[model samples]
Target chain A: TQLLEQSPQFLSIQEGENLTVYCNSSSVFSSLQWYRQEPGEGPVLLVTVVTGGEVKKLKRLTFQFGDARKDSSLHITAAQPGDTGLYLCAGVSGSGYALNFGKGTSLLVTP
Target chain B: NAGVTQTPKFRILKIGQSMTLQCAQDMNHNYMYWYRQDPGMGLKLIYYSVGAGITDKGEVPNGYNVSRSTTEDFPLRLELAAPSQTSVYFCASSYSEGREQYFGPGTRLTVT
Candidate 1:
């Protein structure tokens, strides 16, 4: 079973739309990170939330960590075509060095 | 710094053949990791090293081997490659556990 589960496996929206992607797990994490990946490339880190109930914003993107540290959400406001790509959520459990990744949410923003 | 780098961006190996995927990080991070990403399945950890000479298996370590003899290099080896082993391989490094990681462009490997 996947340690983390992401919702909206695939999403397609026109430019200027807003959407939110969720990452959920029953296990608490020491830290949660969001990454965006383009085709044929590695995932690039967008943001990291280490404290529970933390909210971070990077320009138009907003990231929230659940108070329980078991879930996270990424919301993009006024999405642009450049926002299209695969968004993956990863978490580090307290006991290990390996990261647990969610399946990912593929987003396509059309002009 | 180059941060993280991987060699042979693409490769194709016949079944039963063996090859190694090279990974190096110039950042001198103490933690390095290998992960395999299959379509829609996200990235699964193949192996990881906390430091030189200290390696551990991750969630999916079958059919794979790794070694970390130096702080900057962590290579993943595949023995008796199979079709099921075909996927995009990513190398990542972090300063410490639970820290943000830097990733390599990745290597696409196909085993026929």
Candidate 2:
């Protein structure tokens, strides 16, 4: 079973539309991270939420971590075609070096 | 500076063939990791090293091996490559064990 579960496996929307992706898990995590990957490249770190109930924003992207540390969300506003990519959520379990990643949400934006 | 660099951006292997994927980081980070991504799946860790001469298995360690002889390099070895091992491999480095990691562009591997 996947330790982290992401909803809306795929999304397609017009430019300027808004969308949100969810990541959930039963286990608590020390921190949660969001990453974005393009077609031929590896994932790049978007943001890391360390504290419970913390919300971070990067331009048009916003990330929120649940107070229980078992869930997180990413919201994008006025999405553009350049924003189209695969979004992944990862959780740092305990003090280990490995991260538990969710299946990921693939977003496609059209003009 | 080059945060992370992986050699052989793409490769093809026949069954029973063996090869090593080289990775190097110039960030002076102490933690390095190897992860594989399959189609429509999340990236799964294969191996990791905290420092030179130290290595550990991650979530997906089968069919793979790793060595860390120096803090700047971590290489992954695949023995008897199989079709199941075909995927995109990524190398990452981080200053701390559970912190944000910088990833390499990735290496695409195909096995026949």
Candidate 3:
């Protein structure tokens, strides 16, 4: 079973649209990370949230860490084709040496 | 720096064959990890290392072996390959457990 669960396994939106993807888990995490991956490439880090209720904005993307640290969300505003890729959420392992990744939300922003 | 480098970008192995997937990091990170991803799926941790001469298994350790002889290299060995082992392998390095990770492009292995 996946340590983390992501909603909307797949999403397809038009340009200039807005969308949000959620990642939830029963286990609490010290920190959570978001990554974007393209075809034939490894996932690339986007943002990291540590504090409860903390929100971080990266240009058009916004990340929010849950108050209980067991969930997180990624919001994309004015989505563009460049935003099309697989978005993955990973929670740091208890030992602080490994990552527990979510199944990922595949987003397609078509023009 | 070559954050994380994995060699043999693509390989096809017949069933029962043996091969090793190589991983190296130049960022001087102390933690390295090996993960396998099947088609249309997320990465599954196979093995990981914290330092030279130290190693541990991850969630899916079966059918895989790893040795950390040096801080820069962590290789994944598949003995008696099977079709079920076909997947894309990725190597990642991080300064610490909760820190951001740097990942290699990947190694696509097909065990026929």
Candidate 4:
């Protein structure tokens, strides 16, 4: 069963354009995380949100965890060519350390 | 320090063959995990270990096994390769639950 669902499986935009991607789930999570994966590379941790309704910023990227703890969103301001990659969202529930990952949103920022 | 490292960046095996995927981390983390990513399918956990000598199954563990005999090494074994097992495998480690995990480059495996 897929616990998490990400929207806009693929996106293409001009550099400097703003965009937002979403991750949603029916089950609440103790913590949520975002990862960025480049071609032929592993997914790298971008941020982790533990509190419901929490928000974090990584330079131009803004991430928010829903108050219900069942959903999250990532907004990129002025997307750049370097930001082209696969963005994934994962959630941790129960007592286990394993992560339930979403199918991911693939973004392509063109010059 | 090398956060996490995997061997044989890419591999191809014949059906019914066997192979081990190696993973090592120098951060001395207590938690390690193995995950497989299929095209457009993010990642699915195969196994995990909280510490050396302790291991557990994750969301998907069919036809796969893992062992963590040391803090720095966690190896995943496929007893019999299958076309269904073809995917990109990644190894990650973290200090503990809810912490940022460091991932290795990944092993792209194809079983024909």
How far off is each candidate at the interface, as Cα RMSD in Å?
A: 1.4, 1.5, 1.5, 1.4
What residue pairs are clashing in model 4?
A: none
lDDT of 4 at A80: 97
Candidate 1 per-residue lDDT, tens place, B45-108, comes to 8999999999998888999999999999999999999999999999999999888889999999
Q: What are the per-residue Cα lDDT tens digits for candidate 1 across A1-111?
A: 338999999999999999999999999988999999999999999999999999999999999999999999999999999999999999988775778899999999999
**TM-score (chain B) for model 2?**
0.98
Model 1, which residues run further than 4 Å from truth?
Answer: none
lDDT of model 1 at position B4: 95
* TM-score (chain B only), all candidates: 0.99, 0.98, 0.97, 0.99
- Calculate model 1's interface RMSD in Å: 1.4
Give one digit per residue, the lDDT tens place, for model 3 in B15-35.
999999999999888899999
DockQ values per model: 0.79, 0.78, 0.74, 0.77
lDDT of 2 at B72: 95
lDDT of each: 0.94, 0.94, 0.92, 0.94
After superposition, the stretches of candidate 4 with alpha carbons farther than 4 Å from their true spots are none
